[model samples]
Target: MSTVPETGTLALPPLDGLGQLLPRLSRRWPDRTALVTDERTLSFADLDRESSRVARALQDRSIHPGDRVALFSQNRWEWIVSYHAVLKAGAVVNPLNVMLTGEEVAYILADAGTKVLLASGERLDAVGDELRAVPSLEQVVSFDDCGHQVEQFSDLLAVDDDPGFTPFPVDPGSLACIAYTSGTTGRPKGAMQSQRSLVLNCAYAATMHGRTSDDVVITALPAPHVYGNVVINATFMVGGKVVLRKRFDAEDTLQCIVEHRATLLEGVPAMYAMLLASPALEDADLSSLTRSTVGGQTIAETVIDAWESRSGVPLIELWGMTELSGLGTTHAIHAPNVRGSIGVALPGVQVKVADTQDVTVECAPGEPGELLVRGPIVTMGYFNNTEATAETITPDGWLRTGDIATHDGQGHFFVVDRLKDMIITGGYNVYPAEIERVLIGHESVALVAVGREPDPVKGEVAHAYVVLAPGQQPDADALIAHCRQHMAAYKVPRAVHFVDTLPTTSSGKLIRRHLRSSATANA
Candidate 1:
């Protein structure tokens, strides 16, 4: 192990606000389409005006700067406006996952101490009676008429001018947003993101992806996750027209690309798989799709090849986390990626693998170790969780990404697996991603996930859960044999279970914890 010099923080300009991106574009391309949904299309100027009105309305409700504002809505123009408006008011925007139930939503609201909530009717329905118990929640605004003291969204936009409203004192260091992790490991930790981090990330992404103003972007991922948060801001900053969808439908997503002549597609592995499986793909004209980005999960090798071949677009695998304000590394637009590598770190972002005990000591090239990243995109800390913050960020100022990874001399990175997800069998460490990456290449396997199975002698053993391709006969022994052929006997899974589908988060990240719990329950 060797110690690599930590990339020190830069002296950046005061970002002041997260909502500043759209306004700049509104001035430059006021007439260009900024947001598109099934219900409506909004130009840059329109988005600016509406978001400002929302800010003024929020101000009218006595919501002040530094307060917490929750946005619980499906992907819509209103949701986008509400996000910017909350930031413009200098309040922290807490974007809630649409799939979360009422109880889950209430827990976050109470924890975040959100004073105001802007929810769509559908989202409100998901968290109906549970919200009434939140004493800290003072106001609730709905997109449509939902009773129980919910104010209408249209009413907030009735007055456009803000003569009496005064902009709050905000700085680059202001806590702009709190993006909560999915809590697959434990209770969700709110990652505190600064205004400067958000702005800088947009520029970083634009450079990494070589995005231009002419690109038409399809935001297929949910608006709440970290991936969506950064993608939306970066796409807008690049002056790309965003097509927002409430939920992903493979056919609809492909059609939208053709209809809007979308140049970029953003989604997780599952979404890409569905898009590749879309019957319309065979005949559709997807020449407009120049780039497709995938992350937040392990992508199947076959799925990657299928999408790229069918659409004639390259699938750029990316690596990021909520703590990084979104991304840390990506494949350069014109550069070829190493087979197992995610790509080089973005400009101003430094990534290095380090020994588990000492973050200062770097791992040898091609050796798997914890990845430590230092960049403007890294978060301030976990909100209200000082212990976790201390545990995650090294004293030398590197955010200890819990994912295990390796990089070659050329700077290409390969995310092996989550540190927490590492399985110890017979005193040897096994990474599920390595096994899954190998298994996914098999002809019969469509999707495969590896989990830790309890074993009496070895302490724990690997178990494979696979979903076979359509019409293929279930053959667990064949897969086990395949693993044995490619990997050492100890690293191969002891048993295999065939399933209809594997569990995943909205972003398509395989939730191994869920499978582990199920394995325990079954055992």
Candidate 2:
């Protein structure tokens, strides 16, 4: 399941903060376009100025050092600027998932005690009411025109160039961001990450990915997430131009790569599959793309073959998590995907496969067990959830990654089944426990179990099984529609099944495997 070690790990030298690498890039690469969008572009120098302006805006709102600033917006140049500004101001940036419902967002804002929020238009409306109710939230700014009780992003920039902001001293372990990750647990726990941790990952990516100032990157992931943060920030650190997209559309992403002469394309397996499915891919001039970093779950062999055959670029697969600042094991440069291998641990990261009975014992090669990751890139811990954090990270500094993987003695790794019941559908992480909890709220359901069903397109989707109450009879469409009102769209179960009784252990714990087997039989 593992492959030979990669050509480079984190051979790249370190910097203080992730954004600290920017000023130097701007100074050296002055007029080069630092970021590109469909409608606007920002040069290296412009990015510095914009970041300064954003920092000043936060200061004007009385944001203090170490305060949390929630960035509840989609991808845009401003999003990048806000990231730099928040860091410069010595405040932690909480990148809110754009997919979460308003209530879910409000919960995070309240938990993080966010003072200032930068949101996109639709995002503003989605969370406006909840945001207004959060007393800790002092100000709100929108990147686009929205008739909300908030300041316009453009108006904030009209100040007489005197942003009056200064960079604050930062420690390697100082809290830099609180990225909320919904794992197998029903609730989203904020993973506390530091500036040093993120910058280390970015620097490592910049070195290992072979990026240069002339390189142009096309991103196919959500920017608020850690993966997108690493790709976008790493590209910036390498003084490359970023072609930012609000959403990942196969045709649009491919067209942008060709038009911009992008040198790198980064995405998850679902994204690669979608790109391969694109009609434009057959004729699109993709010579500009040198390689593609396949993030998230390892891709299927046929999909990888199709992508290599179609794009003529190597789909370099890597394994990582939000806790690890977005990178872990990646293949050696130009190394082929050998039998679904995720490759060895990246530079600066120490990985081991431990036995289930005794974590102290390392698993032999090709033997599936719990995967443990250790590195500076790992999160400090979960915010305000010390118990969960304590459970995840051993006192000795190793993080129980909660993933089932195997590693060969030569420093290679391969994924087995997931140790956690988190389903990845269309590149989105969907925790079955979260969906199951929500479904249990339905009055018609006496009991419920949620599991993943194999999907040809999305990879896998949530499939919920329900046993109705004695007299109540609920329809599938209605139950699904109800879930839409409670959770994000991507989290809604793709299909619903009604059963007389669900299989369970003698101790009364619902057996998900039995349900999965039944689903397979029915399919």
RMSD of each: 6.4, 11.6
Candidate 1 per-residue lDDT, tens place, 38-113, comes to 8999998898888889988888889888899998877888989999889888888998887787888888888889
| Ten contiguous residues minimizing lDDT sum, candidate 2 | 4-13
Clashes of each: 1, 3
- Model number with the top TM-score: 1
Candidate 2: give its CA RMSD in angstroms: 11.6
Q: Write the per-residue lDDT of candidate 2 for residues 101-173, one digit (tens) a residue.
A: 8888888888889988888999888778877668788888898998987898887666556544446668878
Q: Mark the regions of model 1 whose C-alpha exceeds 4 Å error after superposition.
A: 1-15, 162-169, 300-302, 516-523
Worst 10 residues of 1 by lDDT: 4-13
lDDT of 2: 0.78
> How many Å off is the CA of 408 in candidate 1?
0.5
Residue 502 shift from truth in candidate 1, angstroms: 2.1
Model 2: pairs clashing at backbone N, Cα or C within 3 Å: 6-332, 9-347, 10-347
